[model samples]
Target chain A: MLDINKVKQRIESLKKLPAIGSKSVKEVLEENGFSRRDFLKWSGALAVSLGLPATFAPVVADAAEVSNRLPVVWLHLAECTGCSESLIRTDAPTIDDLIFNYISLEYHDTIMAAAGWQAEENFEEALKKFKGRYVLCVEGGVPTKDGGDFLTIGPDAETGLSKLKRTAKDAAAIIAVGTCSSFGGIQAAYPNPTGAKGIHKVLNKQVINVPGCPPSAKNIVGTIVYVILFGQLPAVDNFNRPKFAYGMRIHDLCERRGHFDAGEFVEEFGSEEAMNGFCLYKKGCKGPYTFNNCSRERFNQHTSWPVQAGHGCIGCSEPDFWDSMAPYEEPLANHKFESISADATADKVGITILTLAGVAVAAHAAISAIKPPKE
Target chain B: MKITKKIITKIEGEATLKLYKKDSLIEFAEIEFWQYRGMEEYLKNRNYMDACVINPRICGICGHSHLIATSKAIENALNIKITKKAKILREITLGLEIIQNHIKWFYITLYPSVKEINYFKALEFSREIAKIIALIAGQFPHNSYAVPGGVTCDLTNLEIIKVKNFLSKMFDKYQEIIDINGKSEDLEILFEDIPKETGKGINKFLVLGDNLYFKSNGNAEFIKEEDSISLNKNVLYKGSFYEVGPLARNLENYLIKKVYEKYQDSIYTRIFARLYEVNLIFQYLLKRIDEIDINEKNYIKPTKKSGKGVGIVEAPRGSLIHQIEIEDEKIKSYNIIVPTQFNLSNGTKESPSPAQASLIGEYEKQSDLIFKCFDICAVCVSH
Candidate 1:
């Protein structure tokens, strides 16, 4: 009971914007040799990925096509370029369309054609031209130690920290793209030699965080599209992640939840229970604590996520995951401390408590036997 | 007269290339990786197992390679033995990583720079390969699926079917690329258009790690000695620059032995080697997937203890090595020599580094193409 003609009409009007009307969403898909059916499928999948109903696919398609694509300046700092790579490697819209049709990726160090001074010049021009309007997407963390000397950006000897601050001053909003940019990923782990910090800490602002080791491409694109459509940042959780993407714990919607509740757990990898697709909680899955829509919006075009692949979630989307999520093979919230000499203090304490309880029970039984005639 | 210092773009991470030119002929080219996060230095005193998760974040493209390397290093340190099924799964994941990486390099990075081949089709193929990776390794870019003793994931029949289907489709697409570029089934023709002497470096090839597709050529002793002695801030082997990655892997393969015999080390050979490996690795992955038995144990519980060990993996780019010294179950000191450190090192007094030497000629117009031939990953270099 779908009105294909009405949907096409809605798409037609949506593609009428002067800035983005040159290539209709349909035309863009066709240019990429994708049919209208493929576009609809993508829109529906994107809607689901964004935690919206299938009926909202038309609205998403319309919002994506009609809105004037924002000129995005993506910055890379003291971390890997994985976020950008993930964005480009998405299968739904194709990376080419996402770059060319959706957003004006004015300056990206990894993928841009301009090199050296020219690239720097392009960034300056874009910043000036779209001042107080453009959206700044930062992928990596900022190294704040030693006056930000750890990570430098341009030929002018400008550090990444300094550059980010200057660029963010005029930006309408910022999108912290990955865990590194959002929560000082691995670089900010123990010892943190270079003193890397996320953008929120450096900027002291409520930048929308898409916090995953490398967040799903759909979430990244969906958040940006929401910004363009609503002319404001989407609703975010306490962690500054969009509610649509990071609203619920991965455990809430995990496919293995039934098994978890049924008390069928995978104690060991490649065990019979593991082969039968039991819950991975016992093997240290952090899905119950981690907040990300990975279970529903699986990576690589909804193929499969970590739990489905028989691995427990490492809680990459959470803040301070490196420190808080250590000893990945053990369950969270379970406490057992062991010293470097392999002395188990927690085990000793447990044994003492159990022995004392047993002795108390025996003493009470003997006392009761002695007083048996009183009742 | 003046050093043409320029910031190189279109690579994974950012770097500054300083061409010390004397007249038209370049005397030397020094590649300075200014972006440093000190990952190794910061890893000190942290839990040794955390390295498996942290090391992968060094470079997004080759994160799985790092994860496997870290896991292997920990396994070596603990003397833990993984089951055959776990080893096969690890190799499958690694194979998928390499295939996806090479496809992306060919289509996304290299083709656009060289103005050769269809980028979109190549992107689609790589995306499929990434799906296979995610199917097995949980996700691409950063998945800590490989723990110390074994991988976290165990294969089910459903996963096997999914991976097999994607692999077949990928094989077909790869053949299409060969057909379109080479006019034959053989992929060597795809490199026929590549100019000789382009991006040629020292003939010395260094390959480490053993997998189903690739095996070290009985050079373990030499590799260990070189790994221990020559690895510093400026990574070198036997006091000389050496090349690693696809070209090195291809030099050892029999299928592409003729190509290696013809062109020892050049841009043409490097590109051909990468393309050849895509086909070679795809076939190997399919066979490995079929060989996997889900009934076997996937991991052995690792005990907290003190030890020192070195782990090496043939990453998509080259050999990724991780050395860990554990004291009381915590990492006392850790050293990581990424493949880029081997290929993209700053030159020592003995000779110009491989990356620097490749850019010595007057090919400024084809500088990006020449650089892409090396598959430069600045993130790994800086890490």
Candidate 2:
């Protein structure tokens, strides 16, 4: 169904442009929907669509070899591996291809084949070999409770907290890839037992945090590209994430923002109001409080994100996505409210009114029956 | 020997794996999710819409899955039927997440665990793949695009083109990745001379199955309804206990035999499977883009209805189900069952936990084995 040659030829043409690669050229084409045939038939038109320099297609092959691929060491501590799950699903460059040609991933625990002493050996070897020149990506927060027994790496001399600290010390830069590593996420929420913390607190150094339940692939890749292209970190937010990615609020870009502003909400599910695509705010949409481009970058290769799926933003991008945002039905309340508290919709109003009316009638009848006897 | 193996450090939430071993082998194991947010209990008597907000907070990576599942649950409770557009939109969003999640795990999570593979490049590759998807959604790791009745965003022709282009880019990347294992005869011979780590032969793989055919118009029909996987859905494992997570989802799709037919049941097989998913989803996304008629109705408005509703979807982690009871515009009772519950729950006498049951007679290192069998997210578990 998709013409492969036309795509390849256009990619070849785009490769000729300055600062472009097979990867980037392909990205422009895919994002703009210029099939290979489209490229072959209308390179100029496709170029205009992607806002590309006209000379891109002629010389891309020469520029494709500048691989500033860095070695990355990913550390996990207190986490659910959801960040890991999120990381594996990048549709644009697809992780597998990246691993094959672009970057030199030296060591990690989950996807690697080496285990036990050998796995640990690989980590140590990579540390010594790639020290101060590798990228350190942390997915989970570190537990600082009781000498960090909350997490350990292999029933050995090294604890997870200590290993993260040790590994982070030698890295050129650290990418905190998830909310857990960014701000301790839920493990550190509400009386954190392990004293779980983000990389900034544990490492005693500044790290770029790509925060989210699992940060989008663009933020992660764009930041990496910025670093690769410029040999330095991109401009970042106060939270240490690149400003380019974490700049917008979910509500600002929401398609249903008009409905929210109009105060037209779905009062009940399966109701005509709900079927009509009303606002989910009263239904607990957190687009107002959350920050992310979910409305713009629908998940699954731009297919859709959570909100488009007929749900509301749950604010997974913020710190403490679990504890701070839970009782998911209630609005953001001040402290002192119990965690996981429900909202008022659970008690149907009709039942309460019916119960009250029935009780009143029964009371009156009993009273009348008793009055006759007394008289 | 009484061996106390304590596994901790968390991603979404905190959890500890305490294993009792005999002679350096696991005799028994207990995984305790350390954090309990009590969200389910707190959801009592709350506005049904609250789920959209709270459920996503259950776990960051799968928060989108929670948002969709929770919304479906509320819709079910209210006995509301969302529009075909809305349903397809939900599926697309989830599919995107699945693509992102699978790539993340394959490169960031699974590949890192392998001793022979280089993961820094993997991270780069993974991020690039993520970036393409992010361009459309604008960011990664997490995106909140769903609303109560439909998504808050709409795609333009240019944007649709952008998605198709991104998918094409992903295909090129996938081909390159496939080439790494020596797809080229010359390169294979050159690489073969150099000693490299290969997969230890293991014939164990688990998968969830989705074998329903979509109509030419792109609408899917259900073979049966069982919380998740309404259209000819089935869960299978070698030992009756299949795996769940990115690996399982990829395997399921692979079993459907639409994408990534090259690799199967090896270290590279597993890695390539996840990578292929990114490419495969691109095809699906392209088709979906065409199927979406902007002029078509986005949702179906529902009124107060007295009935129960159940919503189910295949989460990035696995099958997620949410059931609720609503009477007269209010929730009478609410129940949510996440994929982790089915995968991690202690099974009946006849069956062990899907993850645990698969661990029989396999005396690999506890940590490595557990990571392979399951993606344990305490945040999803406790929430």
Candidate 3:
């Protein structure tokens, strides 16, 4: 038989730790209408999403509650507000509680009550108050064409790039929230009239990229919590994305990897192979090349992800995905030459190479037959 | 006089609104979209099919609609006939996107500006709807599930059961919002107190494509294609400044027609129409799921590649149309006329833009509410 009273006492003591002070995790959970069991389950899921073991759930929860909640100044620039949308709809803590209790979201134009000059004032005040302390979260790409006239945040003459520079000057560190802010998403696609570039290009500073079309909400929160607990950024890859979140290729973690190795592939939509859950590699899946934890940390509260839904990975999180990993329904060629025709497929080039070799061998045989051997 | 210039916030995308006042009364209002990404220019010389993936990034809220429109345009260009199962799945996915968009607009954008409601509940419901989308369409905000020929996903028994369970719960939740004593007349009563002319725009309405509710009549000649640039010359059919979205869909709805008769094109009717459409589409989706036959073919192979085509979808905001010209299997030119371009027009000869027209009155203090009443998506407008 379990000692219920003793268990409650132990939980109470755990809640009183410096990391989890008077406002216990249980209290916050209850306020969000979540039971203690639910909180535990959510924490465990968060731990998994953060690439940590299930046993580390309690530690993660403690770390989340221990540090002083940082003030987040979220700036929206010349891209869609999808990252903010994804962040607000996270299931665990509920966006209401996340903004109200977890972190001080000082300025977000889309959700903040303040508007016009007042909103600008709030941004300035937060910049001054938490100078060199608060995290600067930029969601969209910054346009640098025509002196950055494409995107302006406020009534002032400061362009999006100028504002980002000004804010980063007083920030502890910068977090580029989406692919737009990280690697210049669709806005930076070919013929980029606005000259939209990621934050790393404009501001000569290290900006941790949480790169997805709109990154999974759990990843966003996990990155922020890691910053809060460790008092520094996590280990990043060549792209500046945290290795924990984007360390491995999506194909390595895909459920369809067995089929890929077995050489079974879906040649067409709704085919027998597709129904049998074969590999989508032949169908323009960028999974083998793209690095993201989408397969492990599924979207929409772990319901499903792209490949699971029968589509190929578009390689959205990868840098220059729009230019490099395009023609989303076709396989990516191994080598590309700028001088070659854009429509020259890998099969065509391979056939041409094989034909040239065959002809050369035939010519050598003919020469040997026509003339007497030197010996 | 105290005149507020460039006051904008709480919207999906950014915009600048300048209000000119005379003796405390608003004299005129001007709206400008300061951001432009030039998506059309980017589409030139690219593979035609890539539009399905790239077009969705225009507006995060209505991305799936753009995806569907792009897919449809490609299908039109290639003359590919989609299977019944594919059509139904696409419709269901689009329905989910629109439902989520309307719910977000109501609770997140409109409700905060008007009245305080249980926003958490609304977000929860939207998340549930988004889960259905992610199940079939991969993920929300930028899912390119619907390709040129058909959808990339195929339904299984497990998905069917999951969808059925979700629909039942969604129906119950929706009933709680609109149903009163089993006779759902709550919307009518909720808008009875609102004045008829409040936020009323032009009387003209246009629907570009066929949906569960309305059938496409004919193509509206609103845009003209030039040598290199396509211009929206603001062509008027029977009149100018036509309304789209829920209001246009409800113009034909029998139940909403009763409400529209009372309040012509006011904000109350628009909100009621959206709420009504949400319930109607939810019921429609439940039936649509049952109509799906998993064994049937889902896509038809495309044969033709070089042709000009137009595709239109009823987006959450309004009618979203995509036109593409394919030459030698590459996109020669691409032009898109989103719902925002129509509703948030630069004013026509007959009337002002719906957004600007709504701001014309002594209600300068309520400009934000009036602006949001149009559910303006600046990303779509400037894309």
Candidate 4:
């Protein structure tokens, strides 16, 4: 039987905590013990049921709570606050609250109560206090031309380029939080004007990059926690992202790999194949080249990710997805059969394949028509 | 002074924020959009049908929606009248994309701050949802399903049955979820519970209602139906134009509009509007699927003719307009007005932009209010 009064009592008691208001207390109670203990088991069971990473449960939980929480000094470059909005939405056990309370987030632009010169002062103070100790988290990319004139700092007086470098110098480790911060993002695509560059390029340091239009909140949190626990950053790949997070390509984990192998694809957005969850390769998905934990971390607390929601990977996690991943009608990497040389245009390959398929079908039909009667 | 910020990138391009302080309270806030793709420029000199594949890749989360919208715009420019079969097919795909987008937005963007699950389950849920999405769209983030003329694939009975089954199962789960967590109806009670969104101060509706008298095929509400309001012009609230997006879409709908009108334009309205879309689209998906005609071809292969065309579709975000001017088989001029342009642009002092209206006049603290109002996408706006 479900305990009612006990839950109410727990709510009443938990509400006594300093920050645990009655609203929060009620939420916890409403979820019952599942929010406390069963959430992981439930997720683990579901992951196993869904043939995903089952062991990631405790790993994620334990990563959420580790010792020596690193101080993170977040630097904003040229961009919107969507990345921050996405971040605050991560649902790890009190992770948002924990991020606020437990971890030493010395300076952040979006949610920080301080603004203007006072905000800059706060950043300076934090940098001074946590020099050679804090983790530097960079959102957005650095504009290189005109002395980074594309954006300005707290006041428009000085450029943001100097401000970013000044702060980055004192950091123990650096994390590029978005695709822009990771590999120049859309800003650096095609006709790059501002001459944008990722964090590692501007700083010339081995910064861990978490690339996405806006990366998963859980991925961000897990990475921070991993850093806190292990002291040095987690093992990163060539892109300087934690191997644990960006180790696998999206294709490896894509649910529609079966469809790709079966030669089934969604030719249009509203087709029946799309409703049936077919491969989006033919429709211009970047799953084959993109690398990230989106297939695992997912946006909005695993409710759904991009592909699951009926869109393909635009290779946001890759370098210059906007420029390199363009002409969405074609794939970025190898085309199967190596049939058409990599240099061949999508239209040419498509036409050639169509012709071959037509000829093959015609020959098969003629042979069938001419075949002797079977017993 | 104490300062706090969540450094996040990868959601919708790159976003970093810095807050300034006067004493203990925040005084000024700066939001930076570092990445610019120049999509308008990218579209230049490309085939008009390029949007069918390219627009969807703009933002992984809403790519399919963009693709459909772009395709619709092309259909309009080309004067290609779609049959009911094509309309239903379009609706089904768009509806599914909308459903998944909203659900994922809730799970990934909104739910994290709800003080519900810890970080562990959040990751787990994200993975599961991504897989489920992949089962349908082939990949996550940016799926390119919208093709010019019509959808790329035809629906088989088996595929339709599978989709119907999945949708039914998902809806049942969501119903239980609302019942447990609290339904939008509970939120609707904000008329009495939350005073800010309702009462006399409620804003007027600015929508794309077709009030025309004649029967036009591509019209949203009723082709050429009277009483349909023209939403082409900017929305004037008080003395200025208010932008549209998921929130604006909700205002146009009859049901959630009531709840949101009650909330006026608070964070509740912004959040609820998107969630309600998720719920509404689920129903729309079923209806669209039922109306689909399997026998008729969904697409007509377009010849790469030398001409210009514009495409527009109602993305999950809002009205996405793509204009393409082609010359001698190459794109000459390409212009796109994304939903974010309306939501995030800086407006004049009088009426202010929709995001600006939400911010300039109201709210004691500006950062939170700005985030609520702007609903910004640095990528979409900048690029």
DockQ of 2: 0.12
* C-alpha RMSD by candidate, in order: 7.8, 14.8, 7.9, 11.7
Chain B in candidate 2 has what TM-score? Answer: 0.72
lDDT, candidate 3, equals 0.73
Evaluated at residue A360, the lDDT of candidate 4 is 31
Please write out the lDDT profile of model 2 over residues A75-178, one tens digit for every residue. Answer: 76666565655555553334323321234334555554444456567778878876676778887778787787656555363566888889889987888877
Model 2: residues >4 Å from true position, as ranges?
A: A1-70, A79-104, A113-117, A143-160, A186-196, A225-234, A247-375, B1-48, B54-68, B76-383
Q: Model 4: how far is B264 from its true place, Å?
A: 8.4
Number of colliding residue pairs in model 2: 127
Candidate 1 local lDDT, B123-208, one digit each (tens): 66667778788888877878888888887676668777887887877787777655323233333444456566577777777888
Scoring model 1 with DockQ, what do you get? 0.47
Q: Write the per-residue lDDT of candidate 3 for residues B1-383, one digit (tens) a residue.
A: 55687657778877677777777656567676777788898788777878888888888888888899998888888788898888988888898888888877877777666554446666777888888888888777678878888877777878878887887788778776664132444434433544546777766777877856556654755553221112222323454566778888757767788878987877777777877788778878888888888788766678896998888888888788888899877899898887877676665223676766766664666677777878888878768
Residue A161 lDDT in candidate 2: 82
Q: Against the hidden true structure, what lDDT does model 2 obtain?
A: 0.53
lDDT of 3 at B207: 81
lDDT of 1 by residue, A17-105 (tens): 34523555455567778766666666776677666657778776666655444567888888788887787677345633443324644
Flag the better candidate by lDDT, 2 or 3.
3
Candidate 2's interface RMSD, please? 6.7
By descending DockQ, how would the candidates be arranged?
3, 1, 2, 4
The residue pairs that clash in candidate 3, if any, are A19-A66, A284-A330
Considering every candidate listed, which one attains the maximal TM-score?
3
